[model samples]
Target: MDLRSHSKPIEEFNFLDPAVLDNPFEYYRAAQEQAPVYLMPETGMYLVSRYEDLRQVLLDTETFSNNLDGYGMLQGENWKVHQGILQERGWPDLPTLNFTDPPVHTRYRRIADSIFNAKRIAAISDRIEELCNLIIDRFIDRGECEFVSEFSFPFVGTIISEQLGLDSEKMSTFKKWGEAIMAPTSRVMTVEELRENAETIVEMQHFIAGKLEERRKEPRNDLISALVSSRGSDGEELDMMELQSFMRQFLSGTYESVVTMISHGMLILLREPGVMEQVATDLSRVPDFVEEALRFDTAVPGLARLVTRDTELAGVHLPAGSIVMTRYAAANRDPAKFDRPDKFDIDRKDKAHLSFGTGPHLCVGRLLARRELVIAFRTLLTRLKDIELARPLPEIAHVPHALLRPMKELPIRFAKADAA
Candidate 1:
C-alpha cells in the first residue's frame, strides 16, 4: 500500500482531530518520512514517529522521564483545576507504575513483577483457556454476536476483576472507572466532564481502599491479597495512597488494551481472506497472528513522556520539560523497521513491535495480555467457524479518544464448528 501522498503539510496536521484519530496512518506516514520528531502545533509536544527513535526514547529513561507530575493528561489551566478537585474531594492522584521514573518506580515495579511473574502466568493459563471457552459458549450457538461487548469486554474484564478480587458482575462499573481514569490523558474534556470523572475516580479509590483493608485482615488467593501482603526490596509495604494509585494503574492499563486487541484481531480475521482458516487449521499460528494484530493496530497507540533535558531525536531538537508522545502505532508501521509495514502479514519474521512498549516501562501485564489473546483466539477459532462481519466496515465505529483506539462494537456472524 502506498502511504506516501498526504494532502496537507505536516505542521497543519492536528492530532486532536477526530477524523485523524480514526484514520491516522496517512498522517503517520507523512510524519515518518518528513519529520520523524514532528511537533504538534496545538500542544507544543514533540511526537516521535520512527521505531528506532521511539526505542531510543524508551531506553534512555534519564532523558525521557515517565513522570508527568499529573500533567500527563490535563495541562495548564485544566491541570491546575484537576489537582484542586482531587486534593479537595478525593485522594491526591499520584504517579505509580507507568507514570514514574526509576528508584521510586523500581520499588513499585519489583512488587508488581513478583505478582505477575512467570509462575503466576503459567498457573493462570488453564483458567484463561477455561474462561475463553466459557465466554465463547455464550454466543457461539447464536451464530451472531457483538464481539466487543459480548466477548472481549467480559472476558478480559472478568479475568482482571477476579484477580483484583472485584465483583465480576460489576465489570461495567469497573469499565467506567477505567475510562474515567484514562479520560484526562486520552482527550480534552469539558470542566463538567472532568469534575464528574474525578468523582468517579475517587469512588473507585475508596472502593479499592476498602478491598485493601479487607485483604489485609483476611488475605485471599487473589491479586489484592498478594498486593496487600507483598513488600518492596526495602521490606516496606505500600501505604494506602500508594496502593490506591497502583490499583488505579492496574484497572486502567489492563482492560481496554486487551479488549481492543481481541476485537481488532477478530476484525483482521474477518477482513483478511484465508488467514482465519490458516490459524484454525494450525493453532500454533495464533501467536503470530496476535503479534501482527498488535502491530497492525496497536491498542494504546502512544504514551506521554516528559523530556528531562535538551535532546535531539531523529534530527529534531527537544527542549527540557517538554512532553514527548511516543507514537508506538506509527513506529510499529515504520517501513525502515518492518518491510511492507502497512500490510498485516502474520508470517513476517520480525515480531519486535512496540505494542507493549519497551525498556523499563514496558507493559507489566504483557504476558497476561498475550496469554489472554492466545487462549481467546485459539478457542474462538476452534469453536466458531465461518466468522464474518455482520455490518460493513464503515458501519463499525471506534470510540473517539486521542490515546486509545477501542472499537465501540464488533458485530460478527459465525457458525459453530463441529466438535472435534
Candidate 2:
C-alpha cells in the first residue's frame, strides 16, 4: 500500500509550512485550476476542489469508500487513535469516525443521530441562547474581545460539556488538548507532543468512561445517559468500547470545527462592517451571514480520501487505490458557483455553500454548530457597539494546520450594540 515508490512530491504538501499553511488560498486555487482531480507530487494524493467534483466524492461513499485510510483523519498519521482503541478494549478507547466506511459508518451515524437529533437540539435552543447572551454580556462593555478565546471557545466548550453530561472543568482540559491535536504545526507541542497526546487521549477516554458509568447508575436527560443506557432500533446499548469511541469522535471533531466557525466568522465581520451591522440589527439573518463566512474563509482547508477502487472522477481516470484530497475552502469560494465569490455578502441567500459539505456524510453537528454561531453573532452585535480589527489583517497570524483554517488571536473592542 506504500505509494513511496510511485509517490507524488509534496513541495506543496508542505501543509506544515508556516507561510503556505497560514494563508493557502492561492495554492488551493492553483491546484483546483490545474485539475479538479490530479495527484500532487507533494500531497501524495488526488485533490478534488471544484464544487461539482468534491460533491461527487463525498456523496458517493460506496465508490469512494470510508475505511480508515480512505478518510483523511485516519491516514498514516492517525494510526495511534484507531489502533490504540482496540488494544485498550474498554473505556479508554479512541472514538473516531475517521476510520469507518459505510455499514459500520451507518451504525455510528445512527448512534450520533440518537443524541444529536434535531428535536433534541430544538429542546436546548433556549438554553443555548441564554448561554450566548451571558457570554456576550461579559464582553459587551469592553466593546471588543478575542472572539475565539473570549467568546467561541469557552461558549461551545461549556455547552458541549453540558450536552455530554461531563464536567465544565474537564471540558476546559479537553479544549487545550483538542487545540494541541488540531494544530498540525503547534509550536508549543514539539515531537514530544505526540507522547503527551497519547497520555491525553488515554485520560480523555477514562474521563468519558467514568462519566458513562455515572450516567448508567443514575441516568440523566443528557446525551451520555442516553447513549450509556439507551438502545439502538433493536433496543440494545452500545458496548463499552463503542460508547467510548463515540465520545472520542464527538469531542474531537466538534472542538476545532466550532473554533473555526468563530474565528472565520469574526474575520469576515470585522472586515465588512456593513454585513456586521445588518446581522446585528436583524439577528434572524445570522444564518445567512454565517453561511457566507463558512464559504468565505472555510475552516477546513481540505480533506483527504484514499481511493479504494480504480475509478473516473470528473474526467480523470485512476487506479483502484488512490488518495483523494477534497478542498472545501477553494470550492466554497469558487466563482463558478458563487456570485462575487471572493467578496463577503451576508445578503447572499443561496445556502448552497459547501461549508457543511454535501452528500450523506453531511456534518452531523452542523445544526448545533449554526445555533451556537447564531447566538454568538447576535450577542456580539448587540453587546459590542463598535468593533474593529485589533491588528492589521495582513500582520495577524493564522492557525498552523491544514486540517482547519482559524486565526490564533484577534484583538477587538466595541461598545454594547444595545444601550442597556
Candidate 3:
C-alpha cells in the first residue's frame, strides 16, 4: 500500500476530498504510515492515524488540547455558529466535559466517577438482562423485524432516558430534540430550516428545566435526582450552569454513541452470516462480538486534538495550533494492530482498539454501553429463533454524515412466536 505517496506535501492532502470521505480508509492508511502528521489542505488540519501516536495524544492533554477549533473543524462550523448552536441557544450544553482538558476534566470526572465505579457496574448486570428480555419479547414471535427500530434505536434511547428519569410521554420529543443538536454541520438543514430547528432545542431545554423542577418537588431514584442532589466532594452543589452542562454531557455521548454500537454491530453481524450463526448458537460470545464491531467500524470515527506546543511524534514535526485528527477508523484497522482488519471476527483477541478512546478521555459510560449491547444481542438472538435481513447487504442505506455508523433501517422476517 505504499504509504509514502501521501507524504508528498501537506498542501496536496485534501481531508474532505469526496472519494476519501466515501472511503476514508484508503487515504487514512496512507496518511498513517507515510505521513502520520500530514496536514489536510482541505480542512487546514493535521492528521494522525497510527494507534501508538493517537494513544499518546489522547493521554497527553498538556500537549494535545480539545478546544473547539483545536478539535478539527467540521465543515460550516464557525465560532459564531458554534456559540449560537451550543451556548446561547441551550442545545444540550453539558459544560463540554468530553471536549474540555484536565484539572477541570479531573474535577468534573470525580463527580460522576463515584456513581459509575466498579461495584455499581456489577450491580446492574441482572437488571440489564431483565430489560434485555423484555425488549426481545416484542420481536421474538415475529422472527423477522427491523433491528434498528425494534431494538438498537429504542434500546439506548430508552435506557438513558429511563436512567435520567424522563417520563414516558416526553421520550419522542426528547429524542427529536437530541437529534437536532447532535446532527453534524455538514448534515444540518438549510439556514431557514435551522432556525426552525433551533426552536425545538429551546423547547427541549425548557422540558429539562421543567423536569428538574418536578423532580425537586417529588424526588425519584434516578440519574436526574442524583444530579440535582449531587455535591462535589467538597459538599458544594452544582451551579445552574453545571447542571445544564451535565445533562448535555449525558445526551451528546451516552445516548448517541451507545445506540450506534447496537445498530452498527447488528449491521455487521447480519452482513456476515457465519458470524451471526456463531453468536446465535451461543449467546455468551456477545462480548467479543461487540468488541469486534467497535474495532471494525468504530462509532465516532475520529477524535481531533490541538497541538499545544511544537512537538515531534513518529518522525513528524507538528507545528503549534495544528488541529490533529486521531483517526480511530484508520487506527483500528491498521494492519499493524489487527490481523485481516477488514474481516469481522466474532472472536478477536486483541484489546488494542480505541473505539471508546484511551486514557483520560476514555468513555466514562463504557460499562453502561457494553451492558446494553450484551443484553440486547443475547436477548434478541436467543428469543427470536430465525431472523434474516430483508434485502441484500449492499442494498442497505445509511446516513453518511452520521458520526455514529448506524443502519438507517434493518428489515427482516422471522418465524412467529409460539402461543404461551
Candidate 4:
C-alpha cells in the first residue's frame, strides 16, 4: 500500500520538481496515507490528495473560491506587469466562467451550458467520426506516425477552431495561441516569457473579437455566434470582455486537455496486453476504456482554488487567502474510493473519478470531449491494425507543466486494416 516508502519526508516533497512532475503517483499515494492535506513547503499551497477531501472542496465552492486573481503565480508585481501588457494591447482581463464565483459565474455558465448542450454534441457525432477518419487516413498508409502531432493536436485543434467559425487550416496557429493563453497557469514564467505570452494572447483576443463582431452582424451556426446571440437569465448578452474571456477559456481548455486525453488513451491501449484488441473488436467498449484512461492518467493533474474564508479540510486548518490545489490526479487513484486504484481496469464499476471535476463548475465541454475521444479511438482501432510503439517507453517524455500532463510525442507503428 505504501507506494513511495523510500522517498523523502512528505514535508520535503516538492510538487514542482521535474522528477515528481514526471511521475507523481507514488508521491500522491504517500500524501494520501501520511498527509491528506499536506502543505507544500515550497509554495505554501495545500495539496488536497484524498478523494473524499477533494470532493468536499469541489462541492463547497463558497469556502474555496475559483478566483485566481492576485493568487498563486498571478500575484504580486508579476501579475501587475502581465495585466499592463493586456490593457495596453488588448481587452483587460475579466473573470468570466472558470475564474468567477457563483452568482456571477452562474450567468456565464448558463450561456455556456446552452451552447454545449446535448443536442449540439449529438449533432456533431458524425462530424467527429469524419474528422477522425480524415486525420487517420493521412498517416495510415505510412504504417508509422507520431500520434501526438499527427493525430491528437490537429484533430482537436481543427474541431475547436471550426466550431468557432474559424479556418481549420489555421489549426497550428490556433494551437500556438491556445498554448500561449495557458502558459501562465501551466508553469512559472519569467518576466520576459510572461510578456511574450501576453502579446500572443492579445493577438488571439483581437482575432476572436473580430469573429464576435462578425457573428453579431451576421450570426452563423457556430459557438461564437451562440455566445453572441444567447442571453443570460437577466436577458443581457455577454459584453466584449466576457465574450473574449469565454473564447480564451474555451480555446485553452478544449485543445490541451482533450488532446492529452486522446494521446494518453492510445498509450494505454499500446501498453496494456489484449486491451486494445478487445476494444478494437467491440467498438462499444471504447467508451469504458476512455473513462478508465481519464481516471488512470488524467490530462489535468490538479487545479488551484483560493480559500475565501478560513476553513478546515481533511481536519487541517486552511487559512483565508491560502491556495488549495484539488489534486484530481491523486484523488482519482485513491484506494479508499477506487479498488486497486492504480490498476488500469476498464471494467471497473466505480466511475466517480473527478477528472472533469464535480459540482457546478464542472467542465461544460465534457460532453464534446467524451464524444471526440470515443469517435477518435473507434476510428483509429477500425482503420489501423497491430498498433505498437515505435520507440521504447522511456524515450517518450511529457511536457513539464504545473497543471496539465501532456506527452511530447507518441511514435507508433501500425498497419492499414484493409491492407492487413
* Per-model TM against the reference: 0.96, 0.88, 0.86, 0.96
Give the alpha carbon lDDT tens digit for every residue of 1-420 in model 1. 578554367877788877788888888998888888988887778889999999999998999998875433654476666667778867787777867899889888998998888888888889888888888888877899989999999999999988998988997798898788777877667777777877887788788888899999999877889899998888889888788888888888889889999998998899895888899999999999999999999999888888999988887888998989899999999999999998889899999999999999989999999999999999998898988989875542677676788888888998889889
Instruction: Score each candidate by Cα lDDT.
Output: 0.86, 0.70, 0.70, 0.86
lDDT of 4 by residue, 186-209 (tens): 666778887787888888888888
- Model 1 CA deviation exceeding 4 Å by range: 4-8, 70-72, 394-396
Candidates by TM-score, descending order: 4, 1, 2, 3
* Stretches of model 2 off by over 4 angstroms after superposition: 1-16, 69-96, 180-192, 393-396
What is the C-alpha local distance difference test score of candidate 2? 0.70
Model 3 TM-score on a 0 to 1 scale = 0.86
Clashes of each: 0, 21, 6, 0
Question: Which tens-of-lDDT digit does each residue in 1-420 have in candidate 3?
Answer: 444334344345455554445446667666765677677765566777878778888889899986553211452543344446546656434444666787777777887776566676567677667766777777766556677777776667776777677764466776786676666433435555555566666766777777777777887866787778777867888876677667767776787677777877777776787888898787778888888888887877876788889998888788888878778887888777787776787767786689888877888888878877887777766666556777764443555552444456777776643333
